[model samples]
Target: MADEINRAPAKVQSALLEAMQERQITIGDTTFKLEEPFLVMATQNPVEQEGTYPLPEAQLDRFLMHVLVDYPDADAEHSILRIVRHEQRAKQQSAPVAQSLVTQAQIFAARQEVLDLHMETVVENYIVELVMATRNPKAVDPELADWLEYGASPRGTIALDICARSHAYLQGKAFVTPDDVQAVAFDALRHRLVLSFEAEAAGVTTDDVIERLLSRVATV
Candidate 1:
């Protein structure tokens, strides 16, 4: 996992993502395959954007979710303080956190379960419509045409479907629904979209555009 991934140069970002996509590392003329259950979690400091290089759309789309984590609420902050003190105490006592955890095989099996979850035709259609809307927002609403520089690729459609299913699975559901799609749409598509200068000038974000798209695009 990388912190301040935005600090990495363009070539470094490219190499990293290439390794992720190929699931292999290359040294000289040799390539080595990555082990199963490979995952990369990265963090970007939004407030410290001054020196950071903005990740290109190609690199951004490599991530399955672009969850925006914000500061904890008052109660959560107090709980965090308690957790820190508890951690210190645990360290002093040489206590470990919980020992229980899922293995790679278990995680892979869960992924299989998500793949097996039933997705109805209309829900699939809804996902397609949402992606199509991004590509051709004017087809959905005229004003949206000014907001997008370019729509998401077909890859976005696949990402949306898989993420929606993953969402439903995580929620302990056996079937996928429009709500499942809605729950994961923002994180799935936020980094995929390329906003227009007009959108930026208007202080609009991809999240804002995605919200509008969700409201307008419906299965019914």
Candidate 2:
């Protein structure tokens, strides 16, 4: 996983595009394919951060999701503090590290099961329409018509389906639902969209547009 990727140079960020999309990175004269279940997790600092570079749109599209990590609440922060103190105490005592409960094979099998989860045609169409709305916002609401410079690509469509199915599987459901799609839509589609100057000038954000589309789009 790449942390604070926005601190990397433009060329360094561009280099990751191929590895992320194809799961292969070429070095010298040889190209190597990553093993199964390969995933890339990159964290970006806000553009307003000092010395942070904005990732190009192409590189951004290679990512499946763009999750915004908010600060934890008081209760969660207290838990985190306690956990860190415990770890420090354990390290001081040289306590043995706990063994992993899940194995690589188990993770692979779980992926297969998530892929096998069933999705109905109506839900599939709903996913498509959600992506389509990003492209043609005018159809859903005229207020959103000029808010986007570009919409999500076909990759967004594929990501929405897989992520929704995975969400259902995690919930112990055998079938995908419209709610699952909506739950994951913002993260899956936010980075894929390019906002227009008009939207920016009006202080609109990708999340705002995504929320609007979700409310406007019909399930059928």
Index of the highest-lDDT prediction: 2
Q: Which residue pairs clash in candidate 1?
A: none
Per-prediction TM-score to the true structure, in the order listed: 0.92, 0.94
Residues 1-220 of candidate 2 have per-residue lDDT tens digits of: 9999999987677569878988898887999998877888999888998999888888888888999998999999999999999989988999767899988999989989999999999999999999998899999999888899999999999999999999999999999999999999999999999999999999999999999999999987
Candidates' C-alpha lDDT = 0.89, 0.91
With candidate 2 superimposed using the best TM-score fit, by how many Å does residue 77's alpha carbon deviate from the native? 1.5
How would you encode candidate 1's per-residue C-alpha lDDT over 115-145 as one tens digit per residue? 9999999999999999999999998888899
Clashing pairs in 2: none
Error of 2 at 23 (Å): 1.0
Per-candidate total of colliding backbone pairs:
0, 0
RMSD of each: 1.8, 1.5
| Span of ten consecutive residues with least summed lDDT in model 2 | 9-18
